[model samples]
Target: MLPLFHNLLLQLDSASGILRITLNRPSKLNALNAATIEEIRQAMQYALDAQAVRGILLTGSGDKAFVAGADIAELAELNEIVGRRMAEKGQEVFCLIEESSKPVIAAVNGFALGGGCELAMACHLRVASENARFGQPEANLGLIPGYGGTQRLAQLIGKGKALELLMTTDQVKADEALRLGLVNHVVPAAELLPFCEQLLGKILSKAPLAIGMIIDCVNAAYDQERHGYQTEANLFGRCCGSADFREGTQAFLEKRPAAFTGE
Candidate 1:
């Protein structure tokens, strides 16, 4: 089912230089059904057009689940050919999340399993609520994460932990997730929103072009070879010479909070 506010997988609002995208369907524990997937794709399109939006915060509608996983029922009936197509589509959608110019942060509030883990991993960063738990339970169902889970999880948490999670199909507690570097921050359930907002406050104030460049360079580093460090160096130099650089430096010298225009 579509969200009440829009034909989106979730609730989206643009305010304070941030876009808060809530994974709706609380009644279903916010599972990633087909409609939810389409809605997420639509939300990404909306983010592309809306100038006021800067950062994206992805979270579940309630405290019970971020997303249990993809709609397994949908996957059960697929044969070889259709399953391949489904995997391809899922990859495209997740790549769109990773490659978006704006910064994307996943606020994992509850159960982030399988595709849920992939979704969070696709984002630039993740923060979780105290109640959040994470896993890749695909092995239990005689499957694997179809949405870049194996690749991204290894990249974020190192190969050992990724393999462990995949092999054991066990869920880790929120603190364990933090220690493993799967999530940037973990806070009390009550403080989840405030913590996410605080993190975005810092990111939203940074130079927009620089942030975009950062994403480009990081993705390049992975998309190909270690040669991307050269590109990173070049972009760093460019940022140092940009207008935001000047404004930030001058503000520092003036001893007041920098009034960054994101120029």
Candidate 2:
């Protein structure tokens, strides 16, 4: 069974092995608050542990936003210590999403600003709608992005443009975001979830073990303590030892489709 949340909706398509997590606070534009963040952590944990879930798709309930930002009222109540704790909590949860073994994609339907943008960046891939807008506008509120945005934004785009956006508090339209590599694809708002499913379907068809290893190796590239090349080699060896790898090679030789059981 799927985990229930007060601020989120979880639906899993067993045939596709895709778990869809919809941010349901449409009245507040699905703003991220402490409660919502905790719920996301719990939901993500469930998705990761569920054997039937091959991929995850994240989006907001309405067309207006994936998530606008953090709740302003919540922010207003933070002191320096509490603010630091909040930032740490958000970073920890977002890191869980980033390091997930299963693929997690963001279907950005509309505004993805501040914490929202950070959340999107944590996903393995992002597919944005034509009306989607991305920004790290925390500067406008006398703050900076606290949830890995400063790092991921620069890594996705570049340091120069990321700095420009972060410092200027400028919004990037979907087309521009696509051009800058912030999103993998941009489609009509109505096609957002469909496009994401199509993309995930393609990815999920591959060997699950290899897919997870690729995720691990790619993430290792950004980790200062890890050697990317060594990590890749180790993961490659692991894949070669997996049952799926043997099935894949044998299937190719036999001119038949390989059935990977994720073993």
| Cα lDDT tens digits for candidate 1, 45-135 | 6776677777788888878899888777887888889888877877888899898888988989999998898899999989999899999
Question: Which one is best on TM-score?
Answer: 2
| Model 2 lDDT, residue 250, Cα | 99
* Residue 83 CA displacement from its true place in model 1, Å: 1.5
lDDT (Cα) of model 1 = 0.83
For candidate 2, what's the RMSD? 0.6
What local lDDT score does residue 182 receive in model 2, on the 0 to 100 scale?
97
Task: Tell me the whole-model lDDT of each prediction, alpha carbons only.
Answer: 0.83, 0.96
Q: Any idea what lDDT model 2 has? A: 0.96
